[model samples]
Target: DETALGTLHSNRSAAYFAIADYANAIQDADECIRLRPKWAKGYFRKAAALVQQQRLKEGVTAYERGLVFEPTNAAMKAARDDTILLQKVKYVPYPTSVMAPAKE
Candidate 1:
């Protein structure tokens, strides 16, 4: 039951992240992690939110923490590596929205 709830929250966090709502994503992800501390997806969601918020250092920390819980997780490892590379390269994150002229 807890796992299912955690997964549901994780999914919601991902949706929030997709919509560029990093704050809410982080909040939902935190609740997900609290619901199921051992579930790696929560940490991944949290890390993704932090990264999207431009909190690169914090994101890397969260990702690494998730790796400790799931050393064999390829997705987590890949995301961590990508985040690290982006940090190293000083990657400029793109704006979450694109604006166009309003139609009359």
Candidate 2:
């Protein structure tokens, strides 16, 4: 029954994420994790919601935690890699050419 409840919460979290409701998604994902600590799906949901909210560090941490339980999950690996890329891009400065005004 607890696993079933966890699944329900996980489903709700995904639905919230689909609607761009990162807050609710994260909340439900947390509930799922609480209900099923070893389940990777909950971590995936939480990571995704955190990423959507621009909480990159936390997202990456969540992904790492999930990977500890499901190291063979290709999807989670890809998502984690993408999030790392996003973090890099976020901190990269624009090229001078892009920031400069064009020739008159």
Candidate 3:
């Protein structure tokens, strides 16, 4: 029952964050975390809320914490990389060696 309630709250919090409702998102994320401390997605939800509220620094930090919890999550990896890139560039980007073979 408690776990189910936590999931509902956490999912709704993610929805709220998606629509820029940081306060409510944070509220629900907080509840979710309180209810399920091992849930990685809950932290990610909280990070999204912090991001939407214009607290970029703390938001990325929270995302990093999420990575600690979900190290192999591809979406989180991309988001983390993109956030770092966003901090560095609007137009210019550091060069990266392409992984695939270059065909003429």
TM-score of each: 0.82, 0.92, 0.72
Q: How many backbone clashes does candidate 1 have?
A: 0
What overall lDDT goes with each candidate model?
A: 0.91, 0.98, 0.79
Worst 10 residues of 1 by lDDT: 93-102
Please, what's the RMSD in Å of model 2?
1.2
After superposing candidate 2 on the true structure, give the runs of residues whose Cα lies further than 4 Å from its correct spot.
none
Which portions of model 3 show Cα errors greater than 4 Å?
Answer: 89-104
For each of the candidates, give the backbone clash count: 0, 0, 0
Candidate 1 deviant stretches above 4 angstroms: 91-104
Candidate 2 displacement at residue 28 in angstroms: 0.3
Q: What is candidate 2's lDDT per residue for 1-104, written digit by digit as tens?
A: 99999999999999999999999999999999999999999999999999999999999999999999999999999999999999999999999999999999
**Compared with the true structure, what per-residue lDDT tens digits does model 1 show for residues 1-104?**
99899999999999999999999999999999999998888999999999988899999999998888899999999999999998978876555554555569
* Location of the lowest summed lDDT over 10 successive residues in candidate 2: 60-69
lDDT of the structure predicted as candidate 2: 0.98
**Candidate numbers sorted by TM-score from highest down:** 2, 1, 3
